[model samples]
Target: MSETIYERLGGEDAIAAVVDRFYERLLEDDRVAHFFEDVDMRRQRAHQTQFLSSVAGGPVEYSGEDMQSAHDHLDITPSDFDVIATHLAETLVEFEVEEADRAAVMEAVAGYEDDVVTVAAD
Candidate 1:
């Protein structure tokens, strides 16, 4: 069988780097930066790394709250989800991940859109 995205992306270390850059870009963007104003980024980043590693089929297990429960009170809109997804895609590209691998990763994240997005689109 082919390698998993986690293996292809260089496992936990690379995933950690990607998560850091993804959150950095998200925090810098005007559209989504406000959502993180009160968040504990260090913990968030750690959770995100575990989550992404899990998604990518790594050995890491995500011990954080479920997506729906995590975002239940965040009031996240579809646009917010899109922006975050875009940042993720860009960060993957920045790390020179292959297109197919990036698409697979994005698809994995998109699977949780309904759970993460609490608000309807306009």
Candidate 2:
């Protein structure tokens, strides 16, 4: 059997690093950083790690709220989602993950777009 993306991504520890960097980038970006203004980053990082781990086919189980319900209150727009996705993709690149593996991870996360971007584009 082919190696899972999680294995290819160096498992849980690596994913944690990715999440850390991703959040750093997110917080630095003024366009979307406000969404995290009141958020507890430590817990958010853990939740994100589990989410990406699941998306990467890892053994981690995501017990956080579902994407739609979790994000519904945030009124996330499509552009905000795209910016976050870009941050994630760039994070993967910075980590030197292979293109195909990055694509797979993005694809998995993209599936939740509808569930996440509740606010329509302007």
Candidate 3:
């Protein structure tokens, strides 16, 4: 059997490191920084780490709010989502994640777009 993405990603410790670097990139980007202005980054990082761990098929279960509810108030644009995705891809590259694994991760993340990106009410 093939190794799960979590195992391929080097498990929890590596996921945590990736989350840290990913957040750093997000915070540095003007396009997405505003979304995190009032967020408690420590908690945010924890949630993200757990979330990704689950997505990567780790044993962790994410207990955070559902993606739609969690992001509903953020008024996130598709462009914002794209920027965030780019940061994630870049972070994975920085961590030297293999192209196939990175593609898998990005594909998994893309699956959440409908739930994460909220459109303004007309």
Candidate 4:
């Protein structure tokens, strides 16, 4: 069988590093920082790391809220989602993830957009 993206990306440690950098970029971006204002970043970072690990086919399990329920009250817009996705992609690039792996990750993230963005319901 082919290597899982998690394995290809160096597993949990690498996923944690990417998630850390991703949040750093998100926090620095005024456009997306507001969403995290009330968040406990340490816990948020841990959730994200595990979430990404699972998405990449790692051993970790995501015990956090489901995507839609998690962001339903946040009123996230398509543009906001795009900015976040860009940060994620950039974070992957910063970590030197292979093109295919990066693309795969972004694609997986994109699949959650409808569940994440709630602008129309606002």
Candidate 5:
């Protein structure tokens, strides 16, 4: 795979397609439904595409808020992040994304756990 994350992820259209399936699975997966029940999927999808695109070494720039600040109030547990990651991997496999690229995507997100998930108050 090329060093560019965009080429690894099949570029904008492919990333968009993967994000679509990922959200579809999330909606149907009861375990993750609560996290997204109040979310506006359309906007979320756009944000995810931009986020992933930028994270994956693409040309697109993502100027969104810091991950920790964005997710700090969600009280997202590690397990929740695991479920999301697993489903995302499945979505990528379903779309026939290359294994190397899949690994790259996973590796990229794996490093962001501290920023993406925070323990909710008791």
Candidate 6:
């Protein structure tokens, strides 16, 4: 087996940083702000960090609800998901992540699409 992509992302601290900044951007982003309007950003950020860390194969364990259950009532659209993916990609670039590793992160996110964002087409 190869080193998990999470290790390449610098483990928990790195994943935490990435998630923090990603949420910050999302909060300020007009395109995505509505989704979080009723959320407690502090808790949301923490959950996101744990989720990303787990997804990246880090040692941290995430105990939050599954993606579908977490976002099921939100009525998220493909455009909303697109906005999120863009922010994630931009955040990774801002952190100077390598193209290959960034691609890995994007690929990992794809696995959650069906769960996180349920579109009519899906």
Report lDDT (Cα) of residue 105, candidate 2.
93
Residue 88 displacement in candidate 4 (angstroms): 0.4
TM-scores for the candidates = 0.96, 0.98, 0.95, 0.95, 0.91, 0.89
User: Ranking by TM-score, best first?
Assistant: 2, 1, 3, 4, 5, 6
Please state every model's RMSD to the true fold in angstroms.
0.9, 0.7, 1.8, 1.6, 2.2, 1.9
Candidate 4 CA-lDDT value: 0.92
User: What's model 3's overall lDDT?
Assistant: 0.94
Residues 11-56 of candidate 2 have per-residue lDDT tens digits of 9999999999999999999999999999999999999999999989
Q: How would you encode candidate 4's per-residue C-alpha lDDT over 1-122 as one tens digit per residue?
A: 99999999998988888888899999999999999999999999999999999989998888999999999999999999999999999889888999999998899999999999999632
lDDT of 3 by residue, 1-122 (tens): 88999999999999999999999999999878999999999999999999999999999999999999999999998888999999999999999999998998999999999999897432
Q: Higher-TM-score candidate among 1 and 6? A: 1
Instruction: Give the clash total for candidate 1.
Output: 0
Model 2 TM-score is: 0.98
Model 3 lDDT at residue 87? 96
The candidate with the higher TM-score, 2 or 5, is: 2
Candidate 1 error regions (>4 Å): none
What candidate 6 gets wrong by more than 4 Å, as runs, is 1-3
- Candidate 1 lDDT tens digits, 2-110: 8899999999989999999999898889998998999999999999999999999998899999999999998899999999999999999999999999999999999
Better of 4 and 6 by TM-score: 4
Give the per-residue lDDT digits (tens) of candidate 5, residues 1-122: 54686876788888999899999998899988888878888999998999889878888998878888888878888898999999988998998878987898889889898798797432
Best by lDDT: 2
What value of lDDT does candidate 1 attain over all alpha carbons?
0.94
Ranking by lDDT: 2, 3, 1, 4, 6, 5
Q: Whose lDDT is higher: candidate 2's or candidate 4's?
A: 2
